[model samples]
Every structure is written in structure tokens, then in C-alpha cells.
Target: MGTSNKPPKLLRMEDYPSWADKFETYVQALNYETWTAVEEEYIIPNNENGSNYRLSQIVEGDKDQFLREKKMLNLFQQAIKVENFQLLQHNGSCYSIWQALLNKDRGNPDMRKSKMSLLKKEFDIFTQVKGETFAQLVERYCHLVNEMKRLGIDKPDYEYIDKLANARPEEWGTFIMFQQSNPVAYARLNLARFIEKLEAHELELRKNHNMKSTAVP
Candidate 1:
């Protein structure tokens, strides 16, 4: 029997469409930390439809940033392309399968398993927050504030700081603002830790709800 030739690989990054190549180049220049921060701030929420209310602002912000630094825009585009490619590779090329998995009722066990595996892999790549409870987060925030005060610095306002350090994942914007203010050298550092804790809480909520449903049988 004649051997079947494998399909050629997808176009190289340089051979991609002009826009895509530009974006890819921009993304390649960013350090992993900055790239991850940008992805978490923009791309993830957009994928989940969490940016519906802020779509205009998000687009405008992107345009302004891109205009100011074409490289940054290119990186943003590249990161999104990479994410899409990963999803497609995982789920196969069947749009029907994708739709079924996206639809709550029609989703199959296999699809769910695949998706859970993907989520686990992605979550593992991030730094998990140390504390799991709300109180623990609050305590960390207080400690951070006190440390700043001890150094004879005008610390971030306690009220605003508490609001963010203890916020739910849905309140991600609040935490981003806190990171920007940088009341302490560890502001973003602590915020990343707190976000990891929130991810654990969200998973627990899903698991408990699923258990409650199964128990009804």
C-alpha cells in the first residue's frame, strides 16, 4: 500500500496574514508575566462574555493602546490566536461538537471531561493563592497595609484596599485598580495570590452544586 502523506503544517508565524503576523511579533516580545496579566485582564473575560457591558470601553482601550504602541496590539492579537488554536486542537474541528459542549443541555460526558482536563491544565499554570477563605484574605490585606505604614509611607486607604483584597472574582476590575495604585511593593503580588484563592472557592461552589443535583436522584 502507498503511504499517505501528512498534511502540511499551518503557515509559519511570519507567513500568517499581515495582521496576524504583526500581532504574533508583538506577543513574542512580551515577558511571560506581562503577557499573562494582559491575557487574564482582557482575553479571558471576553471569551466568557463577561465584557458585554464594557465592550465599548474595551475596544476603545485596545485601539488607543494599539495606536500608541503597534507592537502591543500585535501581541494582543497573537495571544488570542494562540488561545483559539489551543481550543480547536483540544476539541477537534467539529463545530457541532463545540456547540454541543457550549450548550448546557446537549453537552456530553466526553466533552465535559475534555473541558475539565483543559481547565485543570490551565489552572495549574498559574500561581495558586495561599489562603482559601475570605477572612484569610482580609488578614493578608491588613498585614500589607500595616507594613506600608511602618515604613513611614502613606498607605493605600484601608477601606478601598479591603474592598479589593476581599472581592469576588467577578469584581476583578477592583483588584486591577488596587494593583495599579501600588500602595505597597507587593500590591500586585498579593492580588495574584488572592485571585488564586478565589479560583478555588469558585470550583468548590460548582462541585457542591453538582453534588446537590446528583443527591436528588
Candidate 2:
């Protein structure tokens, strides 16, 4: 049988704070002494092969290099603080605007104008959609209107279901109820099935209308 050697123990750096501090102090002291010795040894020009560069040259070069590095470090630290402050200020401004838009009291005119402008832009975009039936328009408008209501935006006096029925009487009864009651669930699960049914109904209507037109001819 072969004998196996045990693995060496591993110590974590975090587990020896006091020892690490003491070790660092001892190392710094040794480094200073060794650096002095190297300086003294290099003063006499002995023609050793690779030991041509003296400690004095390295230290003198490193002084300027260290100062440049420190300046760069300080610049980055200040930049980080400024960036954080700007982010906080922007966040606060957005929050204030949102609160003002949702407020019921007749407050700032600028806030009211901003809110109205946003609403008008949204409405105009919806109104401009080509190839969308009146029913589609009603659905889109109802959803936006409902969302605004949920967010404490001012509600219109007219009923959404009534508007939907006026737009497309054929689909309004079923579609409006489902949209109003369960908008999320209707969108996620029921829209495809509802559209399929609407297509079938339209097909049937088209067939019946064609038959009537032929009979009249």
C-alpha cells in the first residue's frame, strides 16, 4: 500500500486582521532597510551583469509616476460622487412631476399643461391609426382611459361601454364587458379566442348578405 501525504492547511486573509497589520508593519520596516542597503550597494559601480539600474533611479522615476496616478484616482472619485448626486436630483424631479400630474387639487399650471400635452399626444396617435375599425379604436381608448383612471387621472363624464357600443354595436356587448372587468386576463388569455369568434361572425354575416343580394337580383 502507498502512503499519502496530507494537504497543507489554508488560512484566510480576513481571519488574521491583527497578524496582517503586524506583518505589514514588519514588511514596511524591512523594505525601508533593504532599500537603503540596495542604494548603498549600487553607489559603487561594480560591473555586475543585470544590476546596472540603481535603486535611486527607480525611486526618483516612481515619485513623479505616483503623483500622476494619485491625481487620476482623486479625479475618478470626485466624478463618481457628482454622477450619484445628479442621478438623485433627476429621480426626485421625475417623482415630483408624477405626483403633480396625479394630484386632484387645482395646483401648478405647468404641471397641468404637461399632463394635457401628454394626453393629447397619446390621443392623436391613437386617432391616426389606419385600417383599425371603430371597434379597435374603442378598445384602445377604453384601455388608456381606464389606465388613466387607475392612476388618478381625471375621468371623462361619458361611460366607456356606451362609447364602445356606439362605435361597434355588433362586438361591443361582449368585448366591452370583458375588457373592463379583466383587462389583463382578457389581453393575455382571451384576446386571440375573441378575435377568432369575431372573424367567424363576420364570415357568417358576409355569407348571409351575399345570399340576400343574389335573391334580390
Candidate 3:
């Protein structure tokens, strides 16, 4: 293999259609199984029998495939720039890491600034959609935050929390008011704690609505 033990190369940004294409080309030249690790997302061959398959009983083919995937991941990680590494920090598999990079701005490095600008605009106007549960809203908010962080745009959590607070629906008015009244407590609330409280309140609101609907008229 021409790329023998050579980490996947991060070529000139202009060479590929997207930021991830350079790595894709490198991986394609690595080897059959390693390339498949990213393309087909090769998985360990499973046992045909219904019986439990022990770790010690893993076949040679499956073991070789697993090792190849590990090598691919290690090479990709070691070759990527530190600033760009965040894109794959949460990803485990070769396919996942590759997908994360491809999802970033187009091959043009200049487009990154524009992409960040678009993300900021979206964050400024972000709000929970109607019929979206509090948990779902939090999940969406976190995903946006992660995307921004991956691009090196770090916004204060507290500031974003305030943005989230203001986006609550009319039914959340009382809960919002409660948080507003206790400024100190609200200031102390991080995203996780805020989500916990919101989930509990959501449950209570649903329970009350159900009881009211079932009451004798």
C-alpha cells in the first residue's frame, strides 16, 4: 500500500469538494477492509447460532475487521489538526467521525466564517417548536451548542440558558416566573439542572391537565 502506515492525509482544502473529502481519498487508498470500515461501516461478523457468543470465541475474520477499524480511527485522529479535532471528539466509529467532518462547511476554508455567521443567526432566533416537549427542546439546544463548539465558537452557557428561558411557551409562564423571582437560584442553575426542573414541571402540567379533563362537569 502506497500509504503504508501513513496516516490519512489532510490535503489542500481546494483539492476536494468538501472539508472531509481529502480524508476520504486517503482512506480509500489505505486498504480494502480499512476503507470499508468507513464506507460500508464494517461491523464484527455476528454468530449465526442463537447461543451467546463469548469474547474468547470471536472468529479470526471478525477480529481482523475490528483491528482494522481501530487502526483507521487511530490514524484519522492522529492526522487531524487539534482545532478541527472537536468534530470527531464525540464520535467513535470511522463512519461517524468521517460523517461529522463532512457535515462541516464546504471544502472552502473561507466558507467556515460564513457558516459560523449562519449558526449565530440561528442561535439568536432559536425557540421551541409547538408540540415539542421540554426534553426535546433541550436536546435541540444542546445539538446547536455542540455544532458551534465544533467550529470553535464558544458562547457562555448562562447567556444561552437565558435565551432558552425566554423561548418557553405560554403554558410555561408560571414556571418561568418562578425562576425569574429567584434570581440567585436561577443564576446557579446549569443546563442539566434547568432541564431536570423543566422536566418535572412538564410532568406536573400534564398531570393537572389530565385531571381537569377527567373531572365531573
Candidate 4:
């Protein structure tokens, strides 16, 4: 009976930790020592002349080199983002994904400034984008605020709340006015609490409106 000749499975994209837990196991299984070992026995190939070399002696040197390169390539591939895979796939260096992400984030000053400017514009015009739920809007708002803070543009908590209240629909005016009236309580409400209260108020208003509209004319 003929033996199966199936090649061993190569590390795949799924081996990355961003998606799964296989990368550590895979790395642990890759034995650098075994890869670098020399063979103890000599093999004579057919049609060879006087010189005979050990198969281990010939393959061991290349095996270490091959495994080292494979390990580096696998790490590099794992570090690359799926979105940037096409752009950076051709780059086969040994840099990690965190390094790549850092380099991208710490781009030239002009690029950083440009990104900051765009973020500021988005923040200035920031409202609940159409079809965005309250939670989604809060997430987007907080993201912009955090990004601006990272760029050293942090403002006061009240200022952020003021901006958020301004961005909210007119239906939120009652809550905004109530906040304005109760300065002490309002001051105690952090961004999260503020958003939660406003969202609850909006929901209550919606429920009341729905109930009224459904009543007899």
C-alpha cells in the first residue's frame, strides 16, 4: 500500500490571537532546537560519486534557516490588520503588529494634525447621525472626545456635556432645562449618567407621544 504524502498544515491567518487562541500553542510547538539539530546518520544517494554526505548534515543547516524565517513571517502576518493586509502583505520584515499600529498612529506631524483637524470638525458638527441610537451616538461622541484628549485637546466635563446637550434633538430640551435648573445634581452627573438620563427622558417622551397619538380623536 502506498503511504499518504499530504504536506503538514502551514500556519493560517486564524492562528492570530486577535481572532482566536491558537497562536500561543502554535508558537510553543515550533521547536527551534529540533529545527537546528544535525542528523547522526549518513545516506548514500544513487548515482553519487565518491563523496557521500549525511542527510542530517545537509538538511539540518537549511532546516534551522527555514524555520527561523517561517516563525518571523508568521508573526509578521499575524500582526498585520486585515484592512491593511493588502498594503503591507508584500512587506516581509520581522516587525510586530503593535509596532505597525504605533507607527501608523505616530505618523508625521502633518498627518497627525490633519487627523486632529478632521476629528475636531466631526466633533463640532457632531449630532446623533441619522438612524443612530442613543447608545451609538454616545459611543461616537465619547470616541471623538477621547481621541481629542489623546491629541491634547481635552476640555472640561461640563463643556463636553454642554456640547452633547446642544447636539441632541429638540426633544431633549426638557431634560437640558431640568439639568440647567438643578446645577448641583447636574454637576454630579458624569458624561455617562448624563447620557443615560437624557436617553431615558427621550424614551419616556416617545412612549407618551405614542400613547397620546393612539388615543381617540
Candidate 5:
């Protein structure tokens, strides 16, 4: 058997397309503490006068600091951009480097507010695009809701259900019609049941359309 030469898939920050796209993946990779252990364990010691030396100026004699610096050097080499690499190079210690990276990548309060506003605006006018399946549309709608909640903009479950139902494409008209005929029951139904009922009706409508088309020819 021939050996494959493909690199192993390690979780690297640079793999994601953008900062927003990277947020969830990065959080999962580093967990809740976000590499704090690395920062604490790899401390840079002070000089004879008790003032710490800059990481870039650290000497070769201190094997531990040298190795720590080398690890940081490797991190910068694998960094997404030259600017990021340069920024990381200036850190006095691992903690400072970690803090800098976190601050640069994490969204602040104002940024979160702006993002929440935009997501809410889009959700308010949400619509299933043409040719989009019921499952796909529901998935998108649920994703938007999840993102909003993550940003601390929690909304009621009923509100989400209403918005999702209203935004559905015309192909889901049969489902809407059924809901209209039994408004009380529909209003009382849970999201899972709602999704199943809507998708079932959508499938029935497609089946009927196909049957009619075949009969016509």
C-alpha cells in the first residue's frame, strides 16, 4: 500500500474564512479558559534588577524561556497574516500574547449590539428563497435565532415559530392553509411538531403536483 502525504487536520485559527466564522470554532478549540494554562506555565522571568526582559530580547541560556519563545515563534509563523505575526512578536509574556489575541479576535459590547441589530432586522423580514426546501429554510431560521441568543438577544419560542411560519415560501401554502383552518391547535403546537406537520404537508403538496403533471401528459 502507498502512503498518503496529506497533512493531518489540526485545529488552526487560520482555517476559518473570517473572524465571525472563526468565533465558534475558536471557542471550542480553546474551551472556556482560552489557553490561560499555556500563558501561566510559560512565564518569562525578570532580570537581575527584577525588571522582566522583552520576549524578543530573551537570551539563549535560559532553556525554558528559550523554548517558550520558540513556541511563540512557531505560533506567529502559523498566524493568518503578517500584521498578526508582528503584533504577537511584541508581547512581553505568553499571557500578554494570549490577551492580545483574545481582545483582537473577540467581539466587544458595541460590536455585539451592532451584530444583534443587523440579525434582528434580517429576521424581521426573513423569507425562504425560491427552490429552498422546508428543511433548509427552517435550518436557516433556527440558525439566525441561535446566533441572536448567543448575542444575548433572547426571544420567545412562539415568536420564532410565528416568524418562521410567516417567512415560508409559497410552496408551503398548503401548510399555512392547514394552520389557518385550525388556528387554536396550531398556536398550541410545539416547534418540533410544527416542523414535522409543515414538512409533511409540503411533501404532500409536491406529490400532488407531480401526480397532476403526470396525469396531464
Candidate 6:
């Protein structure tokens, strides 16, 4: 998409890696000088009080460099969709904007190595979010697993099931305990089958809850 007139739109935060790479290539190809500007400076602070334009006017006297920086900043603005841009609070400059988005989606360089640990923590703490639908929970669960895979933490299907069981909500306690006691049966389960079983158990829990709620006092 960056090959076309328009640069690739990073529709989802997860797509940043490829999108950033393509956008970088596009910027370099479009104008090497603009790419040079990006490496030259980080974003200037913006505030109604006062903005430190042109690297706090460090490049202010250098008219040519200042112009290149502005042009690169404009390109960053245009690259992101208007609505998406509005949704974010990106600082000006190619370096700052890129760094901001990168940190937002994927943590900074220092945090990169520990990303697997962070994902594991996320998986460990993950549970049905308040007011989240079963389908939505499943979607989030799947995404987390994919993230773990991206970080090179591939596990057997049954291992995934074990983790999922531990992450389930309180309503799933009985079903989880049953599975826990029957290791062989649970070990045979894959992601889909495990989720299917959870869904069925959820319905039973719901039915019982409804029955008790409607019971005569």
C-alpha cells in the first residue's frame, strides 16, 4: 500500500510493525532529506503557552533544515487518517510521532526483551472483563494467545487449555475443577473444544442463576 500514492494506514495498533516499516521505506523513497530530518530531531513540546518550534528554534536560524522538518511533520500528519489522528495525541516531528506510536503499540527498546514476561503476566491475570460478552472475552483471549505466539511462546493445545482454565471467571469454577481432576480428559482438549465446553457450562450457570433469581421468596 505504501507503494501507492497514499502510505499504508495503520488501521489497528497491532499492525504497527509492518506499517511503520513500510512508512519508513516510503518516506526514504519519497524524499531522503525528509527521512534525514526525522533522524535529526525529536518532537518539540506543544502548548498554548508556547511551542518550542524548530527544535526550540535550535534549527530556527537554519532556514533550510527548519523547512525540511516542517515538511516531514506534515507528512506524518497526512499519513495517519484524520479520525485516527484525532483519536491520538501525537507530538510533532517524525521521530516523536513514530516513537509515540511505537511505544503505544509496542513498548520502547528497553521493554522489548521483557515483552514476553509482560504477555505472560497479561495471560495470567486475564479473565472475563466486567460487562464483557462471552464472544468478546473469547476474542480477547485469542488475541492474547496470538501475542504470546508472536513472542515465541508456542505451547501445546492442552497447555493453552490449562492456562485458559486458570484464567476463567468464578462461574467457571466447578467446570474448571472437574477438568483439573481429570487431567487426561482435559489434556485431549484443544482451544476450540475447550472454549466450546466453557460456553456450554456458561449457559448452565446462567440457567441456574435465572432459576434462583425467579424462585419464590
Compared with the true structure, model 4 gives a TM-score of: 0.54
- For model 5, the superposed segments whose C-alpha errors exceed 4 Å read 1-106, 170-174, 180-192
Candidate number with greatest TM-score: 4
lDDT per residue for candidate 6 within 102-201, as digits (tens), equals 5676565567668988888887788777798877888889989987875577878977887777767776787788877887887778899989988898
Q: Write the per-residue lDDT of candidate 5 for residues 83-102, one digit (tens) a residue.
A: 55464433455556555555
Better of 2 and 3 by lDDT: 3
| Top-lDDT structure, candidate number | 6
User: Backbone collision count in every prediction?
Assistant: 2, 0, 0, 0, 0, 0
The TM-score that candidate 2 achieves is 0.26
| Clashes by residue pair, model 3 | none
Alpha carbon lDDT of residue 130, candidate 6?
A: 78
Quality of model 6 by C-alpha lDDT: 0.74
Q: Which has the higher lDDT value, candidate number 1 or candidate number 5?
A: 5
lDDT digits (tens) for residues 1-217 of candidate 4: 1113211232333323222223323443554332221112112232365453433544665554444544545553554445555533223333333234344454568987887888888878888777888778787788788778766777778878888999887867877897889888878777778878877887898899899999959
C-alpha RMSD between model 5 and the true structure: 7.4
Q: Write the per-residue lDDT of candidate 3 for residues 1-217, one digit (tens) a residue.
A: 1145665445432322433544556666666667777765754444787553454677765776677777787777666766566644344677776666665434346688787898899899999898987778888888788678767888665777778888888778888888879888888888778878888888998899899999958
User: Model 4 scores what on Cα lDDT?
Assistant: 0.58
Tell me the tens digit of each residue's lDDT in model 1 across 137-207: 45554444443333233433443334554344544555456555765644444444655655565577779
- State which candidate, 2 or 6, has the greater lDDT: 6
Per-residue lDDT for 104 in model 6? 70
TM-score of 1: 0.22
Span of 10 residues, lowest total lDDT, candidate 3: 10-19
Better of 1 and 3 by lDDT: 3
> Candidate 5 vs candidate 6: which has greater TM-score?
5
